[model samples]
Target: MSTPPESRQEAIARLSRSASDLEARTTRQLSHEAAGQKAAGQAWKIIADLFGGVFVGLALGFGIDYFAGTTPVGIIGGVLLGFAVSVWMAWRTAQRLMAEAKQHGEPQSVPFDDDEDQGA
Candidate 1:
């Protein structure tokens, strides 16, 4: 008897299924990464907002005094204090975040579950 003809259609279908599976897996992984990035972006925005508020307040105070032809004492003082407070808050937040992250840690699998169950 002659050998069977190579089933090109079957081969193509198998490859198509494998490619679809890979694409699905890759999509899931990318979605997970995107979520993490989104969270990080939110955190960054909060930090930026804090810094921006402090800087804006200081600049506004300075502009008011300068345009009004008033003394630089108050303006300079406000700017210096504003910068110092913002920097201190940022540093403290960073420290606390690191500490909490260390304490909460990452998830891990069960090391040694019993294997005598009915199901293999």
Candidate 2:
């Protein structure tokens, strides 16, 4: 099928509009992906922190119990202490992130690590 050619002015206008639309769409998509990635990374960090705190607490408690000759009491107390430490860590992390966001006018990412106790 043969079709009439688009006028030059019409073609130029159409191309310009398309270019603008494409730029906008690309920008939006990139931003959305960046946000998703940041969220996923943060979520993994929280999960890791939660588990790390519990395991460390348990090990410490068990060691104490073994040295002190306490059996079941040591294990139970270790688990409870681990849970409390985990909660505290989570709270601290959240507060830090919120403060950073407030200070920078944008959300900032921090690497998770075990150095949290280095200062203390």
Candidate 3:
């Protein structure tokens, strides 16, 4: 037997449900894209901080070597200092990012414990 035609109310209800579902899916997709963009921005910031620190250090070191005629000594010290400063800046940025993520209720990575896996 052929099925009966859908009533007006039934059609309206179906359309409303579909709209709600579509809205929900759209919202989720948008959120995911936003999160991806945010993550990419944060990564760039970290990278800039690291590169900037090293470049500044190198420039300053070269200037010092030129003025003092110390050559390798100044350049070597400058590079070392720059690397150290860059590392510190990167570490600080990571900590701040972690704190922000925690505040936002985002999931944080936990270190895997070998002891737990051992089942002792």
Q: By TM-score, who's the top model here?
A: 3
Tens digits of per-residue lDDT for model 3, 1-120 = 999999999999999999998898677667777877999999999999888888888898999999999999888888889988998999999999999988889554433457435755
lDDT of each: 0.71, 0.81, 0.86
- How far in Å is the alpha carbon of 27 misplaced in model 1? 0.8
* Candidate 1 residue lDDT tens string, 50-116: 6875786588668878888776865776677777777777677777766877896873332232542
In terms of TM-score, which candidate is stronger, 2 or 3?
Answer: 3
> Over 4 Å off in model 1, which ranges?
1-6, 67-120
lDDT of 2 by residue, 1-120 (tens): 999999999999999999998898677667767878986887788788889889988898899889999977887888888989898888888888778768868644533345534645
* Model 3 alpha-carbon drift over 4 Å, by segment: 106-120
Point out the higher-scoring one by lDDT: 1 or 2: 2
Could you tell me the lDDT of residue 77 within candidate 2?
A: 86
In candidate 2, stretches whose alpha carbon ends up further than 4 angstroms from where it belongs are: 1-17, 103-120
